[model samples]
Target: MAATACRRGRLTLPAFLIALALAPVVGGRADTSFDTGPELGQRLLRDVVRIEARDLAEHGFGLVVGVDRDDVYIATARHVVARRAPAGLVEPERASHAIAVSFCALPGAPRQLAAMLDGFDGADDDLALLRAPRPSAYVPELKALAPAGKDGVGDQVWQLGRESDCVVVPTPGVIAGRPDTRHTVRVDLHGALGGASGGPLVSGYGIVGLVKRSDNEVIRAHAIAALAARVRALAGPPFLLGEAGNIPPGDPQAAVADLTETLNGYLFAARDLNTLLRQEIVPRPTFAQMVQRYNGSVNRFKAARDKYDGTLQRNWPAGTLPQWQALRERLWRIHLRFFGLNGQSTTTITGTERAPPPVREQMAALEPELAGLQSDIARFAEHLGKRSIDHAELSQ
Candidate 1:
């Protein structure tokens, strides 16, 4: 249905200078299920950015999704700045200067930052990313819904944008239908949506979608979870936009430091698992105890590993990415070996209750390997520290 709307010219792609309006809902009936609080609306306003491409003579709305190192990432609709290519996908419109993004939250003067078009996730998702230099001022931390699926029918949502008079207005809506297409969801708004394409669709405290298009009462938004993955793949590093705060401001070293913290957790968990597998305990624990301990250790290790894996590694020093990736691979191999030692399949470590014969010898064999990996990691950290010092010196 959406595909046909675009092709037949029914779906109006809002451009600059369009007089948009939102008629009041019939009977002024409100959905009593959920109420978007004023406090949340104020917080969301901080990240609502108005984008203007002077060269293309077009303007649209965008959300400040992330700030990574020196870059601030903004998410907007692809059609806002691009036309359909021959292949049906979209490409960035060549411009003389960067697209101007105005942060409405800044007090006094409205500061506009120049943002470069990063990339797009084809026409299906209809999402694009704009990357700009991080401002000295504070950036709002936007949380994204984890499972950004398009299945939230009847769930209340609020779309924040600065389309009318450049003021952030919160439009309440409820997810109406399941989009047959992937990476999209339909929302029936209480009021007609204006030219706010590329704004955020907030549900609760987290952003669930990016407003893509609207037809009177109903609008389509690109789900944030899917948009996150697409942006991660396109932009590389700064993988999780919402988790940018996890890394410090001074990047490269900041990323390295953050990674080291996760690795430390992994080391502690691995040590516990190793000690348990070797049966090196004050009181020789029973098989059940061993199983419980093993499961617990595995969970901790996996958590740490995932944290390390999901980090923004593109700016990690310079040559440290390969080393870190190698270390991650080695850790993964060790995880697989763990299941092997327990006589369990790597795929099915879930609800593992039974224990195999004593894996003392196998566990013993992995000690040297673990020790070697630890030594390598230590060297890696040391290298990272040296590189940080060198970088700081170079900058000076």
Candidate 2:
């Protein structure tokens, strides 16, 4: 990335340029599975800024990924501006002046900003973190770090960069594979250069990784999900690690689909089981028939819980993970109680027959829990429905 108190012109980094050090993707057909242009693109452009020099000597790019009360954190490749960085600089080298920034939001205008080295996984990884000024007047759409392991092979994604001449270019890539030697991703892409260092590789869900380097055959990125846990513990609060609205539903519609399927199953099973006792049957079924119905309902409930647990774990906010665990344990308790009711040896009861106090009380308590669970689930389903990637963005 570039340095400060200088004129706004081209940002030149080491010969490593982006290619010089950690510039920033490669191949595959464009994936329309998630949208990233115009709106989200504009927001990112404002953040994926051009790093300039005080004397107008160097240039490269950095992304504005996070912010706190005072500063905004810029994520770029260490090689791009690492030499000019004075904080962790090796001796004998002159301390470089502060860096200048050319933000896409304020085109043609560059501002002087101190680019301080915050934290970097040197020797082990190619990532670098820089702290910049974030005054009240400045605001860009902040993107959050996606949870690690959420991305899988075949997941479609997009890349953004400021390679040259101040244009923020978008490239499409797919998660092809991961290298065995290092914690780098092998993406099918090309065409990255000096100016493109430190760009972001975004999935439909949100910011998944940052560019490590690009080559003639493959584009590589240092996946951030795993590093996120470490980054959160860094010194500054400016690294607002996991903010909402930053990582929206990568595919909202798909998220809602599973929830609705299992939710409807739950609604039907609960209604049938509860109504079994309420209605007066012309010919009440035997105890075995009632037990079968109860068992079937219980099985359906357990399956639904598993399905729902899968969805919430993936899409729910990190803060809500514990809440989901609680819900899951509660669901298990409900299942166990119902299973016990089915196993009652002493009382053989038909649909219209009332059960013993203990069995009835436990089952009756489930009424309120089930009702509350359904309402909450409905709300969650609706939220997921509305939270999908914009239709236009995901379109081919």
Candidate 3:
């Protein structure tokens, strides 16, 4: 259940994965699109809605936060949904009276969700929290950001945007610095385009900041939970979070490459040791111990995989489920062979040294399975990025 307290002072107002590129251009101009996840229904795009400026007839982005009883709350930049102040002034000229939101419930047919003025903030902060009823299919996870230590220098991040055409595009960037303690995060990237005004800035760990006002040389944003005052006033739970920096979309492949390389390193060592032991270049005890340690490492990975299977259960697809099992079982067999060789005497009662089986063959057999599993991980990551409603009031 969502705690109905302020949780902590929202240090700032704040703010993914690439959603699919099928979004049609709003105008005649050409545009690029994104794909957070298409095979599975995406939740990030579903959570983020396109906000239409009712009277102004303009378009912007809104992040779906949790709901308050009958109404779901959305956090966005005040200027995106407000009437701008007079020239040279900072405050909004007047509050917006009417607004409509669209949800990604059915493919190509966005369901028109709830509408409201619900809340706003002071002149200095470009923050607004609108309350509306939950949508029909895509109830979002109102993920939160770290209230403290949101990020360190050089942390990678994603800038999720909604163009005027309603196409969701995600760009890459980083946390350059924080000049003050007001939780103002200085990002190192180009400012978001006109229609992207209320888009989100995320890191792998969590939501760090809302896409506040920005321009060249002054890429500023409000820290996460900066709108707790407004959120509490409207009856929504403050985000439960920590140091922000949700992983960028590109990282899944990077992680796979890195993890597989580590396994390759281990495989290489095992083969070298086996040859050295057979040739008597290495003593028996040392070879045995090294092989045992390798087995232990493989077992550890299996334990972790077992835990993952237990936790996710039927959520995983049947076809992909056995890839991990196959990988682990292959390694387990290799481990047992090494164990047998380690205990076997070089003399073998016949005064002949034991030779390890050909290693390249094992690697050849393992590589495809390993690569396939890695690909599955990358795809699953894409799915999670879309389905992740970390802060939405989901029933787990």
Candidate 4:
């Protein structure tokens, strides 16, 4: 059971990472270790702009970090702008909703500048560029772009973000590591907070990356130069940038296959639960009752399992155990209540009132079936257990 719980925990980490990544960017608080230098302070304050967007009744806040001519680009996690425009809001099959950008000299001061929606991509880019109608003379002196470069392990970097009310002054840190395949750069910025997405990462000269989200509150910024290159390649010369292009056909198919495999593993894991109930426990119910209950439980599990499987099939992970365990436990308990053995009860049904001989015969036959279910369940459980152990060992 300890091992099982740990396996469930491992499965939950991805969802946790995603949620942390999407958390609202927080403003910076004071840090004695790193002072916001006079020159950097002016640049950071001027470059960091607040992003306010509306999708129907929903409103969102993010940070705008980069500017090109009249276009000011915001860097936020994809989940921040996940909502799509409702159908019929504009032309048939066209999206009408737009994102808005605003900024003020001071936190509570009246907005000094604003712009209507230009375009955005929630998936590949996770960055949105908004074009202002007219160039605002208030444009901050542009921070130098990070040279086209690859960050090595342990490179020093600094991040600027917002907490609740104040803009986070740049907090300095070193690159902890780079992600396996993604354009993620892990840093050690201390005191980074929520509402910090779209904040800038500065080295010596200019912006190196945009603070997207944190991993365990250790700052993680996306490589701005790399992201811009991808965006430009996919969206074409960045003219009024819009949605990032769909994943190429080949990639989507591979994603589908990966999802199918994961779901198969989960289903394989679930079958073990049913088996454990059937074989290890005793005083099992009449075969008919057993079948009826099993069928009902499995049916419900199938419904939820299928929903999750479909999501996995689409190459996305599903809910954590706490999110889905109630239903899972229901199935587990149904098996235990009927099949689990206790000492022969003092209160007993008289043989005269016993179920029909056919029922008894059927129940007798189920012993083998029960054994089979247990074997399958135990096998899958062992497999999943081994996989979990291996992952833990690797992490260690």
Candidate 5:
């Protein structure tokens, strides 16, 4: 029963993997030669628009692909936009909303217009699509829509994206293999870097995949067809017309305010957890030992909490820290678990009891502190629950 209850408090690997699999990819590509000439580059350039977003917490860069009359969609990895700010700055009621995309005509050109993100997915994909009011001047060489097929091992493909310092580059590679339908290609390309995310992977005249990451300089790109199919499924018919339009600028401020609250809530929750561990939970050696067995779970939580607090103080809104009073309530629940204080009220001590008072009294004292910790955690969970995520939105 204890184990089952404890399991409720843990973050399962499968859940984390699902989240990671759904995170958005960011950055641009590096330059290399392609069989297609400069004309192809110019044509593709028209479809590719630089993405820039800002918020109270951070700013980021991304790319927009496929534009039409109604909607001009920007493609990027979902992680770029969905990533939470360091936990320190998060407050109970505030969330860190993403900044708008700053679009420019060309690589070196000044930002021309601002755009906003429309929607995204948080499962099985890491793609996002942003919408702009008007088309930017620069465009990427748009390849024909990919044929209905899957890339095979030894298939030759090409990728185009920007590298560090926003230098657009291309790379050529052969398909290594398909790990899964969602994670399509493992290409053998030269030196992939940080910025070359959300770029195109082409086989023949059609787009085969989107640039995702480079593992030890080996490019790990995702299949375009797979992503497109997911997007079509999620976005329905409207996005297909390329008629996606920008959300009004007035709308984001309120959303940002809400996000700020959510972030603060998460931070407060972390602080609460820290207090509980330090006071009520840590005193119980068995509980401490259990956490320690996980090689630094407790320590990591502490470090992560401290880091988040520092970030919150620097970037978050004032006067939104977690309530100590609420934290006390949560500590009570922790005490119950530590002492096995349920059913017949018999104390089942797991480890040696070396303290002054009877174990029952010690458990009772811990109740309030544990309750306090839970309050903060609950707030953090709430914040996470409210945020919207789309893994497929990150693809281009």
Candidate 6:
């Protein structure tokens, strides 16, 4: 069903292909009469987040619906947080599991934070709330959409979702019908995909429902109006649109420390890629083993690049330090050589059945760049008086 395809805890080949095909295609805008233009869509993204369970392979999208003076509350599908139990009861695993809530849309905000389960309304409601303390630096001013009163059939609506890559986007649709049982309202959105479940269904009026599941044509969502009280109780007081929580001044030393850590992580991944190019490829290992190792290296490189880019976006120590700027430029050049465009890895081997000659040649070509990057990173670490963080540490 659409639920499995859309709420991706882990990316499968089929889901990745589907996401590749449709993720770039943006849906039409909502009616301009209600001021639901590009500006509003961009603003809504500030409150949306991609949720991941730390203990389990469960991932989905959610909304920061309530931000009190001290904390922020996130709402998502219960299935995203807990596994289903027998006799329609929800599992208690959520209470013990640490969840990661990430704000991908808001720039310069803490990219991810640890959240804990705040409340749940069981299988019937299919709704869950999570709470995380507001950060000491820059809290996102959230505009929580209030539950709309009595949404009728044929009303225009929008469902917000995260693509497999965790880019928040909106799918426009309309309310088709209200199912009498289970407090679900069906939506006629055609673009809902995996990694989109647990997103909000909003209309010109307000938040109409929370996404439950979807088939080919219709999407079933838990009506927010029916459980509005529970939501309020769980999320605490509603979020004010303009409320700016306490934002402390930036700490340059702390930022530099974080930047150094992120750089180390990136360099670590880069060194691994370099080793794969040398030890795995040049040795002419079996095709299967080569493919497997190449795939693993691609994943590591992508993750490292994502983290490095995200951290720099939040706080780039290179902006003020000339030496750091030079190091950053070198890193970017290496990153571009490995990841040419659209974030696709140059050394990726898509199908294991056959390792194309062109791919093999490309892998061979990347060796020099990878080796040079490792050397440059090591020298940069040494220049910063941190010999322990050199490329030699990759051995440990």
Q: After superposition on all CA atoms, how large is the RMSD of candidate 3? A: 20.0
lDDT of 2 by residue, 1-396 (tens): 122211123322221112211111223312211233323444456667667654545566677767777877777766665553356766542323667666666665557485656455543475567777775566776443444554566555566665544443556667787534556776776654435567766665566667777765456777765456556667664555453132233344433454455555555555455544333331234333443444444443454444444445565566444554555465545444444443331233333355545544555677887777677666655655655554334322
How well does candidate 2 score on lDDT at residue 63?
70
TM per candidate comes to 0.46, 0.49, 0.49, 0.39, 0.41, 0.45
Error of 6 at 369 (Å): 74
Summarize candidate 6's per-residue lDDT along 1-396 as a digit string, tens digits: 112221112433222122223123244322111223233444466667778875668888776766767777777887787766666675644432657777746545654554555445555577777777765553553433533433667656676665444442445677888656778888886756556777766654356677877766777888765655566554344634321111111222223344444566666655554445433234223333433433443344333333334333344344434555566667666644444322122224222233345544555777676677667666655554432222211210
- Candidate 6 lDDT trough over 10 residues, lowest sum: 243-252
lDDT of 3 by residue, 1-396 (tens): 111222122211110001111233233211111112220113245556667777766667777666544666677877766777678987736756667776533346544544445334444677777665664555454333433553656665565554643343455567888635665677876654455666666664455677776665335667665654446564334432222223222333223333343345445545554445445244444544444545434443443344334323343346444655555455545544443332224233123333334422344555554455445545544543343332222122
Clashes of 6: 5
lDDT of 1 by residue, 1-396 (tens): 011122112222221001111222133211111113233445567877777766666677887766777877788887776555556656744432547777767655455666555455455567677777777785664433423342356656676764643443555788786554586878897465567788877654356678888867888888777777776676452644462122122324334555565565566556666665565232223333434444444454444343433333544445566787778778656655554442232112222422223555667888888887788778877776664333322110
Give the TM-score comparing model 2 with the true structure, all chains together. 0.49
Assess candidate 6 and give its lDDT: 0.53
Candidate 6 root-mean-square deviation in Å: 21.0
lDDT of each: 0.57, 0.53, 0.49, 0.42, 0.43, 0.53
> In model 1, where is the ten-residue run with the lowest total lDDT?
13-22
Residue runs of model 6 more than 4 Å from their true location after superposition: 1-34, 37-39, 86-96, 108-111, 118-120, 137-150, 165-171, 179-181, 234-396
Give the poorly placed runs of model 3, Cα more than 4 Å off. 1-43, 87-92, 104-120, 142-150, 165-170, 179-182, 216-218, 228-230, 233-331, 334-396
- Give the residue spans of candidate 1 off by over 4 A: 1-38, 85-98, 107-110, 113-115, 118-124, 144-151, 164-171, 235-239, 243-396
How large is the C-alpha RMSD of every model relative to the true structure? Answer: 23.5, 21.1, 20.0, 22.0, 23.2, 21.0
Q: Which numbered prediction scores highest in lDDT against the true structure?
A: 1
By summed lDDT, which 10 consecutive residues of candidate 2 come out lowest? 15-24
Off by over 4 Å in 4: 1-38, 54-73, 83-99, 104-122, 150-152, 164-170, 234-396
Name the lDDT of candidate 2.
0.53
Q: How many clashes in each candidate?
A: 0, 25, 28, 16, 95, 5
